[model samples]
Target: MLPQELDGVTLLVDVPLAGLQAGDVGTIVAITRADDGRLRYTIEIERPEGGTADGQLIDLDASQFGLD
Candidate 1:
């Protein structure tokens, strides 16, 4: 079901991926609506040393994740 209210919101995401540390710069590449009507966000993380890593945001809820 869709969220009852749509409003301004912010979320704090913490990813515990291997070799991922703090201070990494990343940009959101795409935001797509899933089959179940949920939104999926794709982020590209740029390592300071010299490489880039891609990740996906999953299993998010509108209420809990502050997404509307």
Candidate 2:
């Protein structure tokens, strides 16, 4: 399992949240388990060029991301 605040890259297209594409670098803000007891992540991706002002925080399952 990944640790909190670890940096990583997205591995899936999270269309609902700012259209996060594959390879977008992000940081794991928090780690929590889903209703099914599966691990989930709250990732904060600082918008490139736009910086944190246009960044996004999204929740995703473990399979949707990887260590950077």
Candidate 3:
């Protein structure tokens, strides 16, 4: 079972960018439960060049960051 109070919380993280590129700051927009009973999150990474990248969050634990 999952918690009942993670619907609209903000997630802040500094994730690395693939393909040897520099990373950017990201924010979590949404969180939902998948069909397989796993949690999924939608993240938006904002770059310094006035662009952003959309990414997915898989197997992420909020408690690891003391958010629980």
Candidate 4:
């Protein structure tokens, strides 16, 4: 299900992997809706230590996160 504000929504990661915990927060940078009715989001996961050195831009399905 899509969030009320769509793009730029803050999300809480629901699944843990690759050193990321379940509650990691990310900010959506872009959104795409496919012709087949699938939604994809681009999010920026900033390093908690406050630097861009290890930050990541990840693309995830809508189910990957929850609105914060």
Q: TM-score: which candidate is best?
A: 2
**Candidate 4 at 49: error in angstroms?**
1.5
Q: Give each model a TM-score.
A: 0.41, 0.71, 0.42, 0.59
Put down candidate 2 lDDT per residue, 1-68, tens digits, no spaces: 45566666655655545666776767888888889998888888756777543457888876777776
Candidate 2 regions with alpha-carbon error over 4 angstroms:
1-3, 14-17, 51-53
Residue 60: error of model 1 in Å? 8.0
User: In candidate 3, which residue pairs get closer than 3 Å at backbone N, Cα or C atoms, i.e. clash?
Assistant: none
Candidate 3: tens digits of C-alpha lDDT, residues 1-68: 44343433333343354311323334555677778877666544334455334343423345322232
User: For model 1, how does the per-residue alpha-carbon lDDT over 11-48 read when each residue is reduced to its tens digit?
Assistant: 34444553444443344445567898886554455454
Clashing residue pairs found in predicted model 2 = none
RMSD of each: 7.3, 2.7, 6.2, 3.8
What is the number of backbone collisions in each predicted candidate, taken in the order shown? 0, 0, 0, 0
Candidate 1 matches the true fold with a TM-score of: 0.41
- Which candidate do you rate higher for lDDT, 3 or 4? 4
Runs with alpha carbons beyond 4 Å of true place in candidate 1: 1-12, 17-23, 51-68
Quick one: how many clashes does candidate 4 have? Answer: 0
Pick by lDDT: 1 or 4, better one: 4
Q: Which candidate leads in lDDT?
A: 2
